[model samples]
Target: MDQWIKTILEEFGAIGVGALMLLENVFPPIPSELVMPWAGYSVSQGKSSFLAIVSAGSAGSFAGAWAWFWFARRIGKERLANWVDAHGAWLTITRDDIERVDHWFNDWGAAAVLLCRMIPGLRTLISVPAGFANMPPEKFSVYTGIGTVAWTALLAAVGLWLGKNYGDLARPLSWVSTAVIACLFSIWVYRLVQQRRTGSPHKVR
Candidate 1:
């Protein structure tokens, strides 16, 4: 993976960093923790500047987020609610739950989207709720951009600090990413079971 990342960074420069970060948002398995820091390390190697990498990465993340946002908008709330009603048991969600979530997102979406963008597992998923709530694109972009930039800068700084030791941290970072995903899945499973047993949606809100 390191070789692949290095190859991409070497071949495409800042564009590769943006592409990787875009993919990282669209596909959760591609951890931004590794991507941004690695890009930072590349900066250390004179492959690119820190600002360029961070800007590109932030742009890519915003694009990926917008993709999901538009997708939810395309589906529309009525259609999504109907599907949830049909598959609520398996999904452990209900139409009422969807409405509740929509309301919650409407109320706190700005903060939620901003804060979640800095979180490992929740970052990508947060965009979905924002979309479902029909958040204004301009507002969503503002908050998402602010958070994404901050997160990207922080990760890139880590890479710069790691410097020659970046390789040493790769494995540990991968483990951390895997653990976060596992923990999120575990929580979902627990919620599913609880909802199933009680015949009620488990409210995380």
Candidate 2:
């Protein structure tokens, strides 16, 4: 990862930042927590502008999300719901849960996309659901851009303030990221069980 990031920074400059952000969305192993802060540190070192970094990151985020959205859109609703019915239990989810989620996603996806983008680990994953729900492309792009840019700004600001200590800052950010993902998964599990036993529609919101 170190060598890969270095390659991106050296080869692509600001564009590389955007490309890596896209990759970060596609591949969870590539963490934005590490990348954005380093971009901030680079700003402190006079290597890049904070605004450029944030814009590039946000653009990359949108592109990556768009890829997922398109993939889900192509997969379509019936097939996905069928897969969920077959495999949801392994993930502690159910088709009924999916129906409720789809209904909610269709109803409130704009806000959902915006809010998830503000979250640490959920931003990219939200796009898949949006696509699965067949959300309007323009609406998805608008909300995604809003949320990704805000998140990029916040992360860049943290990096700018921390500067050289960006390395030090990574530890706690990792913990926070993990905690957030865990919390979300826990909620999904709890909701899955609840809906399964009670036969009710449990909205993600």
Candidate 3:
């Protein structure tokens, strides 16, 4: 992952950061925790601008989230519930569970959307339920942008801080990325096992 991200950032600059964010949302395992910090590191090296990187990341997040939102919108709740009923056990999702989520969305509306964007695994998944519940696109975009920009900024700030003393850690990042990935993977495995055993859909990790 480090090598792939490094190659892209080296080759593509701020655009690469945007692409990485897009990929992270489309493929959740990629993780913004890894990508965003690297972006901040790049900014520290003067390879990219802070505003540019943040904007790119936020845009990528919104685009990916929007795709899922549209998909859920197209599927509609009835169809989704049918799919969830027929196939959700393996996935550990239940019809009632989905409704519970929908009700939550109904009550909280855009605020729930905003809060969920800051969460790690739920960030993208929440968009689906929001869309399933027929959230207004304009309202969704505004809150989504708000939460995404704030979260991405926090990640970039971490990277910038690390960059302040990056000289000694020149060779440490490979292992750092590896360690981060490994931890996330382990957490995912644990959750999958738990989900399968319990026959309930919980968070991915």
Each prediction's Cα lDDT score? 0.80, 0.74, 0.83
Q: Point out where model 1 deviates above 4 Å.
A: 81-104, 164-205
Model 1 has a clash total of: 0
Best by lDDT: 3
TM-score of 2: 0.69
Better of 1 and 2 by TM-score: 1
Q: For model 1, how does the per-residue alpha-carbon lDDT over 1-205 read when each residue is reduced to its tens digit?
A: 5557767888998999999999988876677877887788888777799999999999999899889888888898778777776666655566776676567667876998898889886678678789877889999999999999999999999888777655555565556556755775686788788877876553322
Give the alpha carbon lDDT tens digit for every residue of 5-55 in model 3. 877877898788889899888988788988888888888888888899999
Per-candidate TM equals: 0.73, 0.69, 0.84
When sorted by lDDT, best at the front, the candidate numbers are 3, 1, 2
